[model samples]
Target: MTAPSEAARYSIQMLISDWLLIDGTMDNHVWSAVEQPGGDGAADPDIARRPEVARLGLSVRRAGWDQIAGWPHDLEGFTTWPAPGQTARMSLSGAQWSLVVLALRYWADVDERMSDVDGAARSRGIATSVEQRLVSLGWSPATP
Candidate 1:
C-alpha cells in the first residue's frame, strides 16, 4: 500500500484491453498479457476469449499508475479496460514499470511468432504454450 518504488520487484494487478493481447504482439509501450475472462466463450465478437491465454498491449498515455483518492486508475482515467477497453485484469511481477512493460512486450512478441493458430484451440497446444511462456516470464493467475 505504499507508493510503488520500482525497486520492489512486486507482483501487481492491471486491467488490459487491446484485443491484440491474445496471440498477437502490438506496437507501443506495452505489448502482451495473458487474459482469462470466465464464461466469455469463443462466440463473443469483441475478444473471442476462447484462448484464455495471450499477449498484451496498452493504449495508455503512461504505463504506470495514477492514484485517485488512493487507488490506481489508468492514465486516461475512467477505468477503460472493463468495456472491451480492458479485456482483463492480471497480475505479474516487475522491479520497475518499464521492466513490466518490457516483459509483456517480450512475451507478446515471442508468443505471436510462436503460435500459428488464431484462437489457441485445444488441439494445437497454443494455450499450453502460452501458459508455459507466461509462467516462465513470471505471469500467474491473479489471486482472489
Candidate 2:
C-alpha cells in the first residue's frame, strides 16, 4: 500500500489523542459513577449526560478509515487484531510508520481501559463499545 500522506498522519494522530483522552476519562470517572448505582441494567443516564462521555461516545461512533487508506498488507503476523505488535520489517515511509505506531498505541489504550472495567458485568459494555469502534475502522478480532 502507498504510504499515508502527511495530512493523513496528522489526522490519525489527532484521532488517537481524542480517543485516548475520552476513553481514559470514562475509565477513571464515568464507569465508576455507573457502577455506583447498583451496577445493573443500562448505564446510568447521568453518566452518559456528562459532556466528556457524550463526546467520547460520539467520536467512537464517527471514527472511520477514510484517512488510513489501507494498512500494510505485509504486517508481521497480527498480535491481537488491529495492533501490529512490532514494526514492519519491510521498508515503509515515515508517514506509514507513524500511522502504524499511532494505531498500536490507540489499541493499547483502549485495551487497557477494557481490562480496567472487566470486573463489572455491566461495564462490559465499554469493551463492546471499543470493539464497535475498532470494527468501524475496519479492524476485527478475527483478522489474521
Candidate 3:
C-alpha cells in the first residue's frame, strides 16, 4: 500500500490527539460504541464493532503491520504508551488516521442506531435480546 501524504498524516494526528484523544482514557460512550458489532454494519458484523479489533483482525488476516503497533498506538504509530520517560514518538500516518476515523464513525452510527432501536423497542414493550437488537440495527449473525 502507498504511504499517506504529509497533510493527511498531520490531519489525522490532530484528530487523534485533539479530537478523539486516544492517548487518554476514551470516553465511555465512545468506547461502548466502538466496541459494539454494528459500527461498520459490514458483512463481518463481529469485526465491524470496534476499531482496534478491526485493526487487529485486518493485520492478522492480511499478515501486514503485525508487529508494528498495538491498540491505541501513539500519534507517531509507535506501540509505546504515553507515560513519562518514554521517548519514542512519531506522527500517525494517513492510513492509520483513516482506520481511526472509520472506527469512530462506525461507533457513532451504531450508537445512534442503538438509541433509536431501544426507543422503538421500549415503545413496543419489547424486551429485545442482544442479538435481536443487533439485527434490528442491520447486523447479521456470524455464519456457521
Candidate 4:
C-alpha cells in the first residue's frame, strides 16, 4: 500500500487515561495502546487504528478511523485540546511510526496523569461526575 503523504502520515491518538474518571473526576492516570501483543508486537497491523481514539472515559469518545482523517493536521505536531499544555510522549508501533514526536506528545501526558491518580478508590461523587463527563465526551467503555 502507498504511504499516506507526510500530510496523511501525520496523526494523533487522544488517550483518555488521565481523563479516565474512575469515581467522578479525571482518573489522573497514564496509558498506552499496545497491540494486543501477538497482534502488532513490533509490526503494524493489517489495518491501522486511529491515533486519537479514546476509551474508558466519561467524556471522550471512541473515534473511528474515518474521523481521525478529519482532525487538524496543520498543527506543528501533536497537541492536546483545551490547550496551553505540556508535551506527551508517543510510543509508535509499526505503522504508527509514520507520525512524528509532536503528534505523540499528548499520549505521554495522559499516561503521566494516570500515574498521579494511581491509588485506592475515592468517593462516588467524583466517580459519578466522571461517568457523566465520559458520556458527554462520547466515550462508552467497551463493556458499558
Q: Which candidate ranks first by TM-score, i.e. highest? A: 3
What TM-score does each of the candidates earn? 0.23, 0.23, 0.30, 0.20
- Per-residue lDDT of 1-144 in model 1, one digit per residue for the tens? 433332233333323433223212323222112232354434335364223222223322223222112223454643543354342333323323233343344454544677833432321343344345455665543411
* Local distance difference test values of all predictions, in order: 0.35, 0.38, 0.35, 0.30
Encode model 3's per-residue lDDT on 1-144: one tens digit a residue: 343333332211121122322222124334443554464546454554467554433432232223223435355644443333322223344344334334444444454577865433332222123224334434333311
After the best TM-score superposition of candidate 3, give how far the Cα of residue 48 lies from its true spot, in angstroms.
Answer: 12
Candidate 2, backbone clash total: 0
* Predicted candidate 4 versus true structure: per-residue lDDT over 4-111, tens digit per residue: 222122123333232222212212211233234465535434224423321222122222212333333455543543244322222222222212121223333444
* RMSD score of candidate 2 (Å): 14.8
- Which 10-residue span in candidate 4 carries the lowest summed lDDT? 22-31
Each prediction's number of clashing residue pairs: 9, 0, 4, 29
Candidate 3: residue 111 lDDT (0-100): 47
Clashing pairs in 2: none
List the candidate numbers ranked by TM-score, top first. 3, 1, 2, 4
Could you give candidate 2's per-residue lDDT for residues 21-127 as a string of tens digits? Answer: 33344345434433445555355555554554444333332232223323334546223424432221122233332333333344456556777443333224434
What's the lDDT of the predicted structure labeled candidate 3? 0.35
